[model samples]
Target: MKTVAFYRIGMIICTSSILLLLISSLIYNLLPDNDIPQMLLLRDDNGRIIGDAPFAPSWQFPFGTDREGYDIGYKLLEGAVYTIGAAIIISLLSFIVAFGIGIIGGFSKFRVKSFAHKFFTSFYFIPQSIIAYNILYPVIWEPMEGFTTTLSERIVIEVLVLAIITVPTTAILISNETEQILGEEFITSATVLGGSPLFIFYKHVLPHLKMRLFIIYPKIVIQMLLIIAHLGFFTLYFGGTDVCYTPFCHPPKPFIQEWSGMMGTSYKELGLSWWIFMGPLLCFTVTTLLLNGIVKCIEGLIDHEPYKSKQTSRENETHSFESHSKQEKFLFIKN
Candidate 1:
């Protein structure tokens, strides 16, 4: 087998993720957070959708503007903040729920484990974005009197929905892993030695499972972010809201900048201003790739023997072949 060095691979992936993270941070820091809505509404002399004046890429406006006079550069940065932030929050929440449920359910009494299994299985089957829109809509979003509604409640709903969806999966993953660990020889030995279940789990199992947890973590985050992006594609907003703020109500949407929302807003003009689409698209792609790389690295590191053993086998084969050649020469000389 072609063996890969897990440590080296992890280092490369970590470096890449860091680079993307830095770029995302820089993109967010340079842009004005408050004036984002107004920037998107920028127009030209003819009332066209041109972001800032002159529509040029400069130190001030690195991304240029759009047909609607919106500053593409600033918009991209703001969108990055939203999408990336949302993904992170969603991922973190999901992981927690997943870990909590999975660990408890997996290790719980039979009745509790059974209930958890059925409940999360149902949740796992349901599309998270749909749940985000359907189950939590009424509880989260509040309709406004006059113009478009705000996003506060809806964002909450979105997070809740995402958390729910993630919890089930996370629980399943963690539980399965925990179960396997609990069945291991060391775990069994500790239990036989009068170690408390909790103590063994926390001290022995959890410590050993750290690498596996790392492998699963990025995947969970990636899954949630993908769902968020899909919702953005549908142009689903909190209730009747358009953007984060409507100059009246402040919805939970303002709490985080969503790349999906930015992409949704500019979806129609994607052909005209590819940058509008490209900016968010690129950000999502890079983030996804980075997360994926991290997961692979973790898995590689944890399961180093898979590839390393192959290299060893090949070396052994070569050594054996050399030994056989030397034996033949010695036999011929003796003959």
Candidate 2:
């Protein structure tokens, strides 16, 4: 009961927060001028300027302001859609690709399953983040002239790369799980009862896999978030990284204010204006924790031990009721 309560509470809070962030960001961007201040300065009672940009956390700006005077809190709110939404999309695409391949490989002959397992398992040796960075670097980084691809194109490329890189190990794991399910006694019984592979998978394996899939999805999202953060540290922002070679030009910046992009762009100011980077870092930390919490909730909710015990108790009760019915019928016959 406690676990179930936590699951409900955790889901509600997480879902509500994400919806709020996405909706607020949408409305904020939909304004005519899309007016969000680029700079802000603090003033005293007499209206004399007291402080410049990069203010500490205060009532006026809860998460404080960056060197450029943009509100860190508002930037986080606006970028929530990009960071969270993109991660969700990438994770979902990978899961879908993995699912199809795994289902096919799982239902195949032993040789096919073994080949898939051995082949795809090798992908685990590759460092996903490093490989992703190497592949995505050229296209996502602006050239001396300008970006060859548009922001949308770059984003799509990144998504494909990220999703494709993760499919190997995930598909292998899914295939293995499917094989295990296929080996179950019930699966054998179904097969003996003339159930086809397709029918058995749909009726038996799928129901069992559903809970695991739900649990795995959040884990994949967590991996994606970590990958995005790592890519940011590697100076590969989600959309594009603009490197300014001009002497007086500001440091390299991401095209968007996504959380990873924000972290990448602001890390240089860690010494003096730590808040600039820490603001986004804090948001990332919190979001990761929230996701982990959700994973835990799902884990607790899906624990088979308690459910199995309950199922056993119900079966026992049914047996006892049947025995009692037979005794009453015999007593009536003898009477």
lDDT tens readout by residue for model 2, 154-249? 999999999999998888878888989888876776676556777777667786787788778888898899899999998899899989988998
Candidate with the greatest TM-score versus the true structure: 2
* Quality of model 1 by C-alpha lDDT: 0.63
**Candidate 1 TM-score, C-alpha based:** 0.69
Clashes of 2: 0
Give Cα distance to truth, residue 169, candidate 1, Å.
1.2
The CA lDDT of each predicted structure is 0.63, 0.82
Clashes of each: 21, 0
**TM-score of decoy 2:** 0.86
lDDT digits (tens) for residues 1-335 of candidate 1: 13456566665866566557657766667756646533445566999975444344556566666555566656666556556666677778878777777777667778667776777678667777786666654544334543332455556656667776677767787888888877776566556555676766666667656667778877877887677777666656423333343667533332244567666666765666566666677777877888787877666665664434345434533554565456653334553
TM-score of each: 0.69, 0.86
Q: Candidate 1: deviation at residue 41, Å?
A: 14
Worst-scoring 10-residue span by lDDT in model 1: 236-245
Best by lDDT: 2
